[model samples]
Target: MTPAARKCLDQLRTLLRPASVATAGGFRPPSDPVTSWFCRAVGQPGENLPQWNGRPMIPILQIRIDELPYVPEQLAHLALIVVFLDMEDLPFDKPHGEGWLIREYTSTNGLVPLPEATHDFKPFPIRWTRVEDDAPYWEGACALLNMRALDDDEEAEKAFYDDFQRYDQTKVGGYPTVVQSDVGVEDFVFQIGSEEKVHLAWVDAGIAYFFRAPDGTWRWACEFY
Candidate 1:
């Protein structure tokens, strides 16, 4: 994504509160088929999980985007997103939404109560803290500076770039702190980190990055210790 076309994205800190946490966001779907698929996706049968695994899906967390500090114009349609994971065999190498999924809801009206979680991974309402916009890449840096590249000293510019921190945590936006492989500016969405407070762990303290690929398929990857 270019600076003129995209620029930077504002990020929000997504913190997991107590398991008994309550929030204004609705948990249940309004008899939506996709929502039903989410509830029964784990340890059920067919293609997804819940069949050979025989393990229930866990609710990692949920966020009310409409209640967030700010929503990018491109993602205004999203109203809520529920984070999900399985007992084992995550989607590290498999297709997306197989072992982990981020269920996006366009609206929260008329939402009913969700079914009971199969594991101790109780759903926690997310708390958001708005963070300053991050320089997504070199192009973003240029945009923030309001100048074209190549005017500054090479070493100084490199140092300036290095000084930009890669805020790695469960966040709503901003650039991803990739532990392995290269993640670009386009197609990258949000990420879910290992939060021990709510007993949420991904591949042993790894952070899971969710992306909407150019082909429109959901893709997920995690980085662990």
Candidate 2:
């Protein structure tokens, strides 16, 4: 990795660490995604991403530096979460298909220890349930979001799809969704009023990336892309 990229990666990891969570204080509305907090903490220049609704939107990273306790050692062994957006329809000459990829780098060596996948895929760090289309994945995510309230399940699901249709017209692939059935389900759930709600983060090819909040809640950050 180049020195500049390495520096940014280090900054990102440190910014996401639990210790840094305490220093992350802001006054964004709850409707905002978790990426807002990350943008606030890291202060990275926003990229010109896709637009949602009539307004443009940018990429956002959601991170909770407070809710999850940190172990100094764990920081040394961290996973790099990389999500690929809108790769399904690259130009005819461009390589296409697949949207998300993850690689774990050791702070000790700053290198990817594992061999790369045959054609250059980094499959470790996250067990992703890849969905070829966005609708189903978004539906599942919306359901997980309001898991406690089933009464409005249908409406919630429709709203998610409608929003995506209006804003994200591209074919989205490699979108990852994790539910309670996954190994770390319990840890991913937000405890509220005797109800354990599952957390979810979904990103399209353009703007809108969701992240886990400090209180174990889920939030999304969106801007004109």
Candidate 3:
């Protein structure tokens, strides 16, 4: 990691509690199947690469129970895992290439979730544009959720393609689905605040963590890191 990148990571670590590190437990689909496949087709593996410090570019952030407002008895002992990718590692300018693969695993059992259910999670897409808005290598990814309503595979594919096109044209992106890992969180939902931004519902904690840019500035909704 670059000095600046390392500094940013350190700051992030300070803001959040310690992560519950575990191997992603299930066979989830790529947050962006088309994009994931494209990147893999061009050589990026859908599987997590060890090069990224033994984790996917998208690190899993676990929400501590004590920090939560009201923890259900069933969930009080279970930590919530949020998956995110580093935009700096993506190849935004390159066409038909693979991006990072974001996966979810259980720290308790080291089990990967079922691919079908995990793929259903909502994607959080963000585009980083130059001041002139002429650059194209914008970045985005998804969060792991356990909702079932977002499991519509067909709709998810369509949305992803449409969003990918927009990213190619306007340099914008957003999550494509809503269903996430099957860790048993029922209140999970994708909250959209504006046309350009949205966030994954971390209902258990009542606080939605938005993706901030490298400058530590908030992008619009959907406009996350």
**Candidate 3: worst-modelled 10 consecutive residues by lDDT:** 35-44
Local accuracy by lDDT, each model? 0.51, 0.25, 0.27
Tens-digit lDDT track of model 2 for 76-144: 233222222232222122221222211122321232122111221211111112122232233333433
Better of 1 and 2 by lDDT: 1
Task: Encode model 3's per-residue lDDT on 136-200: one tens digit a residue.
Answer: 11122212222233234545434333433211111111222222221111222222221222222
Model 1 Cα shift for residue 18 (angstroms):
27
Model 1: per-residue Cα lDDT over 132-194, one tens digit each: 634444543443444333334454445445645555667656666555555554555666766
Off by over 4 Å in 1: 1-52, 135-162, 214-216
What clash count goes with each model?
4, 14, 25
Model 3: lDDT to the true structure = 0.27
